[model samples]
Target: MHRVRVLPKYLSKRLDRWRSTTFSENREWFSHLASHGQHPRAMFISCCDSRVDPVAMFEGEPGDFFLVRNVANLVPPCAVNRELHGTSAAIEYAVLVLGVSHIVIMGHSGCGGVAACYDKCEGVNAEWEKNTSFISQWIEVLAPGYERIKDMDGDRSERLSAFEKEGVKVSLENLLTFPFVRAAVEEGRLVLHGVWADIGSGALFAYDGSTESFVEV
Candidate 1:
């Protein structure tokens, strides 16, 4: 058998410090969460960018939000095929089992996944469009958003910024494609939100469905 890798010293030291301080200070709260189980108020679907931390951004505690992270924070339309759907499965559990009241899909500025999708849709990056890359297929969900903004009059950076926000809107729309999610939303049991983050400036913009635009939050 192949030898297993050991944890790096830096990471091990950080864990030890967390266990000694943060964990020790919050032992009772952690125990309560373990015994009572999670009942998150919101389900946050966000990008897998290292700079974006849902808990830190929201100042949330354990069991506060059911967080799901994926490329570009894209949510594909509901498909019932036998293929494994980890994100969809997590969404299902969050909505049906946990009964989360809100679902937020937050995309970020300078998203590599969104950039790749833009490149793929524009027929510019043959490498990203290759069949072998899982990422190439995953961000295909953003194709519709690309179609909407591809012809807009803007520089590359501006278009990309719009595309990132558009990606959030696309995910929100896809979330509604799930019948259960739609039903819950219609029945007033759940609400959906789309947000975009400017990582450099620490700015957040929330999609206003009424205006069909993202406004600063």
Candidate 2:
């Protein structure tokens, strides 16, 4: 027995508004999705930041993408163990079951998770090291990204921007650690993309493997 509460009033009203407007307008589309099932072509891995909405950013519809969001948009290395892995499970389903052709890891500017990792590594934040702090451990996944940018000659903001993009690259590498993901890539069945978004400026960048850098897109 757990305490479950009703939807908040504001959200409830929003749901009603959606039902009357968006849902009503797209009833057939929704019905078709329900009947035929979703067949999204790409799987989008993105941050849980409210400002970063993949659907709106990509101008995509409901069944266009299988989306997985987490703090810092981090992907941990695949490991065999008894512990539950939510993100890994989502990746497995997206690749094997959905058979998506592309997987995108999108990082964003002003990410609090990335900022926390930056502070943690710089010894500016000790709260993340506490035994009871789950966030502390989760953001540790970005430590490798921090390492890549720590010594770079730049101001705080510049270093943070570099670190943010590095986090996307780190996730791309970790994505390959999954044998299924690697096999799919090698077999030409799937593609992996790294992207970063600047929230304030609405600018996007994509990693260009040829240049080994992120180029504005």
Candidate whose TM-score is highest = 1
With a 3 Å backbone cut-off (N, CA, C), the pairs that clash in candidate 2 are none
Number of clashing pairs per prediction, in order: 0, 0
> Candidate 1 lDDT, tens digit per residue, 1-217?
4787899899999999999999999999999999999989999999899999888999998889999899899889899999888899999999899999999998899999999999998889998877899999899989899988999998999999999988988888889999999999999999999888899999999999999988899
Q: Please give the range of 10 consecutive residues that has the lowest summed lDDT in model 1.
A: 1-10
Stretches of model 1 off by over 4 angstroms after superposition = 1-3
Q: lDDT scores for all predictions?
A: 0.92, 0.94
For 1-217, candidate 2 gives per-residue lDDT tens digits of: 4688888999999999999999999999999999999999999999999999988999999799999999999999999799888999999999999999999999999999999999999998889878788888898888988888999998999998999999999999999999999999999999999999999999999998788899999
RMSD of each: 0.9, 1.1
Evaluate residue 68 in candidate 2 and report its C-alpha lDDT on the 0 to 100 scale. 92
